[model samples]
Target chain A: MAVPSFLARERIVAKPGFNRWLIPPAALAVHLSIGQAYATSVYKVALVEHFNASLTEIGIIFSLAIVMLGVSAALFGTWVDKNGPRAAMATAAVFWSAGFIVGSLGIFTNQLWLVYLGYGVLGGIGLGIGYISPVSTLIKWFPDRPGLATGMAIMGFGGGAMVASPLSRQLMNWYDDDYTGAAGEVASGNSVGFLFLTLGLVYLVFMLFGAFIVRVPAADWRPHGFDPATVKQKSLVTTENVSANNAIKTPQFWLLWTVLFCNVTAGIGILEQAAPMIQDFFREGGTSAVAAAAAAGFVGLLSLFNMAGRFVWSSTSDYIGRKPIYMVYLGVGIVLYIGLATIGSSAVWLFVALAAVIISFYGGGFATVPAYLRDLFGTYQVGAIHGRLLTAWAAAGIAGPLIINGILDMQGEPGNLVASDYRPALFIMVGILAVGFVANLLIKPVAEKYFEPKPTDVPEAASTTGDRSLTR
Target chain B: MSTARTDDRGPQEGSKGLVAFAWTLVGIPLVYGLYNTVKAASALFTG
Candidate 1:
């Protein structure tokens, strides 16, 4: 399919005078907008009430969106690479905004399935495409600091909820005069409907700004005082390119996939039940010492840590190298999981601090992976490879919640659970992190067989005919 | 949309301002979000 001329890859190539610094902000604009997906809990109650549906039914919307995020990213990864970031970002903007509009109609009409179809499926595709759009471009532009470049944008995803949560509350209150945006106050269905509409339109503008401002660095571009040859000196870093199809055939790719899956699974164990888990740890008699308000605050604190880790740890990876960073995230993470399970209830501060660090590592794992992929696979089809790798995230998303919730379900009812109740789940996460640790250790460089042949070796007929298959 | 070679001169004086403006546009909202999160998170210790 032909992209619009305006959105064509060649159309948006950067001029020499273009500031590389501008790219991060364009990436941020799209990420921060789509990151609103994380803030769904804010309106979850309203949706449940409006549709008069089960929590499980309402929850499936988020699950489906996530599943679709993985699916669309995997399916569309190459298309995005071939088309360039401008086209991908614009496509994401349209689908994402349309999701809100369609979902708003569902809310207004009290149809649960439409909300699922719109936000879960359509908006999910937007999320997938938007997520990977800027990643490879950032890596290419900042070859000198690929970790920091990718980190800045992924951190925006972590921060998006911070912006969306408050914004959504304020918007919902404005739309429904009867709603005061209080702790238990559920906005009217109409208010949520309007909120969706407003957000859809607003996010459309921001994403388009991102799309318009975005530019691919010219093929020959390199930062002053940088040497491409120096990049190959790092262990596991490669100068050769690997196509996305061939990438999956390499052991290194699956090892990294397992590494991501374990890290995400462990992190989600804490996040999925953050509020209740904290409360349960301090439970004395049937009543917890921790107040409901304090637990809410703990959840907020974790979000801050999660956001901060994406930038801080991934940037740190630039200095220490990507492999060492994963060792820290998974290895130290195991010890922290043990501490949380064993002694977490000993003090409130101990529990909060441990959980905070674990969540940060989880966030770091996400932000660091693109740079890691760039190291092993080269920049040739990194966006596509990154897109395929996100299937681990989708898998971990389901597995993590199930592990935590499943264990907790057996221990006792949520409100009545005690510190011992969480031990089983916490220990399981330790085991999961152990798996990731080994996977990270086992990751060697991609074998030379997987590397794409250099252009010089191409048959003249194939080259002249513009036929990729002959080269393959 | 202008065509220029990669070997050309670095960013001109004009684009410097555009870069700053772009950063500020994205920065304000992120800061706002961070501020709100901090305010809410304070209750973890205070409460």
Candidate 2:
């Protein structure tokens, strides 16, 4: 028997093909730039030494950038959905490039506010826009492989730090001759200014490549043999589409937000103080500065697991479902944090291994959440919902560093951070993750009452007139 | 079903080269970036 007209329409809309290929590069372009957040640690030592800034002061820069990423994303997400990837990516390029330039000026003038303006305010907008540009489009193109599609893009965000960390380190070395300058001493500002300028120009070019290559799939496109019924079989995976505005009102959105917030906060607690945390933990056991630097390098190593887990774990979600995977992330994550609090410092490898697993889940949480949204809300406005959801990230950005550094500051000793000293923070993270775990369990499928389908007139017009069937 | 036949014929036309080129462009960067990341991370951790 022939399929019904409605089924045929659905098939065409869900079809996948060569166009799906375009989404990844489009995503990579933006992710690569925002991924620099991961490598911010590489700059921490340099900034502290160059500006004679305290750790708390330097951390404020990262906090501001992250908070901005969330806020700008929420603000721009709906606009991004309406306009298309081209406009969004182009705007991201402008703000991101401008951020670096502004930051360069700040560095040259010895103005701390400019640095915050350039890197935090300007760069944060770029991070938010770039992050969501390809997300919904890719999910639409690869409906059958939502996890993998989102994973491919998010993996770029995770891996971006791996490239940036080494590249930034190399650039610093290239620009400045004195790597061995005294701890916390200011370096010549000219070199730093020039480096920021060069980075800005290069990123502008790459972001444009992403903007240009991104194209919505032809109308009436559907995957070669897709069966929507199969998707219905996966309880955690939903085929229904929800607009971003409606998604915010649902219990599912808040639950997922809490899950992401807890996961991010837990990871950032260790991440923000990675170098010092490792040094202090091992110092009592007689590990030296060289060993500590190597351990810092191990922290960089976690970015790989972070990157890999984004792709591997989230892609695995396509088959396993989103909720169960998050269960593993939170469940295993709690155990890992508990181990770190209790037994991490006893052996260096134990610390490294447990830290790597926790970091992987941290990265996976980001990669998987978009698909989770796709499952709950449909594709209609998933991008905007994803964008709004980032506010949780912004909150965590502030809360994470504050919880970690605040505790450390209260202790009143610069070099005396030990495993015992970290107990309160670690326990806080454990409780936060547990709360998120409960939220994950509480998440129910978004009800139909919450979903307002896209205007039939608009979708019908596009399907009949536009070349891309998939986007329709 | 008629539309399916048309879709099949279009893929048979000029799409082969475009598909190959796009896949290569996207795949190469992805593979290289993943390889480079894993290698770098390994060196940092193991060394």
Candidate 3:
């Protein structure tokens, strides 16, 4: 497929002395837009009422979107690499915005399957492509600080919901006078349709702005005062390239896969049941001391921690190195889970502080992995490799909810359970984190056989840019 | 001496106005989002 001339990789190459700072905002535009995926919970009740569907039925919409996010990213990882960020970002914008438009049509017409097809399948593709679009480019541009570069961009993803959650509520309120923006008050279907239509147009403009402004670093462009030799000197940091195809064949990739799966699964154990879990933990004499509003506030606080950890910890990885950081995320994560299960209910502050740090480690694991891959595989195809690795997140997405929700279901119903009811699930997470800890410890540098036969680019000026050339 | 090569099109400088404009554009919404989240999260302590 030929890329439109305006969206071609060559068209957006950075000129000499181009500002690298411009690239982070460009990445933020797409991520912030797609990050709306997390805010679906805000309108979940409204959709259930409007569509007259079961909670499970409506929940599938989010599940399907996440599953597609992983699938499309793996499938299109190379295409994104082949096309430059401009082309990939533009395509993601179109698919994402169109998803909203189509979803609006479904809501307006009262067709459940249309909403699924539009939001779940199409919007999900947009999510995946947009997620990886800026990754390798950022790493290439800021080679001196790969963790910081990628961290700034990925943080936008965690922050997107902060904007969308409130924005969607206001938009829904504006579209419907009868709909009070209060807990349990559902918005009308028409209001949701209009909201989708409005978001679609709004995101399309922002994402296109990102696409037009984003630039690939000029061939032979290296940041001043940075040495590739300094990078090579770090243990497990490779200057040699590895094709994404060969990346999968290595044991290190799968070990990292297990590490991500365990981290995400344990985190989701808390996130999936954050509000209710807090209430249940503190329940006394069949009633909870924690107010509903306070529980909601706990969820909000966790989101803040999650977003901050992505930037703070990932940037910390630049100084500490990637492997050591995972030890912090997974190793410290074990002790936190134990604290939560054993004595979380003794005090609210203790419980909140422990859960906040655990969630931050979860978010840190995500932001740090791209830099981790760049460490092991080099920049040749880090984006595609990153895309492949996200399938673990998709797997954990299913496994996390299932494990927690399944255990909770077996114990008893909500509103009647106490802290001990959750001990089993929290302990299971401890086991999961232990497995990830071992996996992180076992990760060694890729063996020599997996290296591309010839190095793709040297620190010298002889090497040129354009992703296609790098892969070849 | 660092073996790294530099692109000699000129010193790697960028326009201050453009950089400021770009950051402000994205920064405003992010700040707005952060403010709202912090306000909501405060309920955990106060409530």
Candidate 4:
């Protein structure tokens, strides 16, 4: 059957000029603020000092927050679709701001539950709502360039940490003197609490700007001079729209979930403990405390590559198919992990460069998946489906940290843990990536049995084009 | 309504100038916002 003309055209309804530019910054406003989650490492030292908590205890807060991000997104995604982006974004601003405020109270009172409540529960909800707010809308706006548009927003999520990591470090220094611990000591709790409040307020204002500027395109919008046939030339591209409910029923959803879960798990294993891991790895070689801090900067530098990869590599997925790009991520990732395991600590830069590439793939997996879904299911409730898929991220978030820290704790030896100690965790990441690689190979064009065409009573333009076919 | 329709003309030569002016107004803030963010980070790091 020939596709409708409206489906073939670009989906955005705005007049040419300012509106196109407006979409990305609005997305950045939300993504950049939430991206602070990446900078949680900066606060770890202070948290450990304040609570006298074990590494496991501190890691729980991040794991809990990530889990909540998936849950809340799954529950609220339908609401985001039903209401306009404005309402959803506005609500996200409120909840996210409140999370910081509550977290501040938790710190003031020295109550850990309140801290969890503020940052984990409330902040996580904010992360969920804020995350989906831009994704579906941007795809709708730039259906012709789904990868680029989504990448623009997702890159902000990756880069948000780059900005936050440095800024948080500076703020901790300013609020409390003794930014660097003399002789490898961690910072204090009070200093950490103050930093949280400052970030919360700044993010509040920035997210509000995003919420204010966000608007849905007029109903009949399409990109000028777009041709659907041009888009259909790629093998992975499809013109069908699948609802979130139907999408979950397919084998493809589960397969893609595995891919994402493995990708994130591998990256977070390094990310969660970058500072200590590097210190341990390089300690025997006379790597000073200054060297560790510089290594932490290298973590931030990896974030730069992570952020750029989200835009650059994922955008490339538009030309090459999603499957091929994913093969690169998994194939190269396996080799990199093996290199770290086998090479030992003799060459630090090799490990760093490989880790940097792997992290980029982790970030790119997130950015490109939405377009991948658009190819399979069309735009029909992709935001909701994407939210559902995020559950994989939540699962991976917990699993990743557990595997990394658990193995380390079990080893029970400190100070320059040899390559031998890390072999188990490294092997686990490789095995997980291999499973995801197989799953990617298994995905086929979504079968028609899974889709239910839009009801005829609905407006033709609104309903027929609901699936975001413009993305293909 | 009739007079208004008669007077209505397609985008004229002046329309191009108006479009340019609008872009300038929007583009300035976008560029400056990015510059300011970088400047803030550099100042914090160096100082």
Over A108-138, each residue of candidate 2 has an lDDT whose tens digit, in order, gives: 8888789899988999899898899889878
Specify the poorest-scoring 10-residue window by lDDT in model 3 chain A: A460-469
| TM-scores for every predicted model | 0.96, 0.85, 0.96, 0.82
Chain A TM-score vs. truth, each candidate: 0.97, 0.88, 0.97, 0.87
Candidate order by lDDT, highest to lowest?
1, 3, 2, 4
Query: Local error of candidate 4 at A354, Å?
Result: 1.6
Error of 4 at B32 (Å): 13
Model 1: number of clashes? 0
What is candidate 1's DockQ?
0.46
Name the better of 1 and 2 by TM-score.
Answer: 1
Chain B TM-scores across candidates: 0.75, 0.57, 0.71, 0.51
lDDT of 3 by residue, A191-293 (tens): 9999999999999998998898899886567887677899888899998878899999999999999999999999988999999998998999988889888
Runs of candidate 2 with Cα error greater than 4 angstroms are: A1-19, A44-59, A177-187, A285-290, A409-412, A453-472, B1-47
Which residue ranges in model 1 land beyond 4 Å of their true spot? Answer: A456-472, B1-9
